[model samples]
Target: MSGIATYRHTQKAPLGLLVYAVAIGMFLGAWFTDLQSVSLILALVGALILILGSAFQQLTVEDEDDQIAIRFGPLPLFRKSVRYDDITDVEVGRTTFIEGWGIHMSPRGGLVWNLWGRDCVVLKLRNSVLRVGTDDAENLASFVNKRLQTEERE
Candidate 1:
């Protein structure tokens, strides 16, 4: 209920879901294990994994008003927002495998908010660069470029 959502996409990440499932399995295994100490440790670690997985199971990008908001879903512990005016350019690009999945600093420079794939839309902002990973690279790029155009016209 903030600005009119011009574009919204949630990148599905089965790998993320799988990671969460594994964490739940670990939790279950903890109960059946004979070693009490090991079971306690396993349960603690499983809880951590579960939190991370829920926090970043998917990535949602919304282009609304004057900014593009990026969020990691389910638990949404991480998020970012970039103003359209702050962005100088947008380019469709590919992230290196080293970057992998999840949010992190890109080896090639800048920060990356990726949910699942290697495809991304790189936004060169006034003070920073953000590589927003997306499965629908073409459409996201097109939508952003068009938004930039509209801003330039005004």
Candidate 2:
């Protein structure tokens, strides 16, 4: 583990997020009749959109010495690490739009750490599953697989 080669992948916020934010604002403004409250609500919603767009905008995958670490951008609140010994299998998979973003439990089972996109690296752990959404799904899966192989030899 001393000379371990680390692999990292980062995802940035896509343009679609801005569009979504605008849609939310429009809907909120239309639903509320009070001009003062509507303005306040709009500001709050705008701030929320900015926070979500920036705070949870990125996902980083790292191959540490003996574990794979996944981090959601700028926020320490959504970081997780799984040791090689605990991972049973890793594969490239797809997630439906219904799954959405942020750190949450996937309907399919286990947790899903996604920033954007449907491509993901699904990890089957000893007792549970974890899906890490990434644009480079194949490379992430291969990286994990290689690490697992190396760990098995040791």
lDDT of 2 by residue, 44-72 (tens): 77666655655676788888787889987
- List, residue by residue over 24-119, the lDDT tens digit for candidate 1: 899998999999998999999999998888888888999868888999987978989898889999999999999987778889889988877789
Off by over 4 Å in 2: 16-40
The clash count of every prediction, one per candidate, is 0, 0
Candidate 1 stretches with Cα past 4 Å from truth are 1-5
Give the C-alpha miss distance for residue 13 in model 1, angstroms: 0.6
Query: What are the RMSDs of all candidates, in order?
Result: 2.3, 3.8
On lDDT, the candidate that comes out on top is: 1
The true-versus-predicted C-alpha distance at residue 114 of model 2, in Å, is 1.5
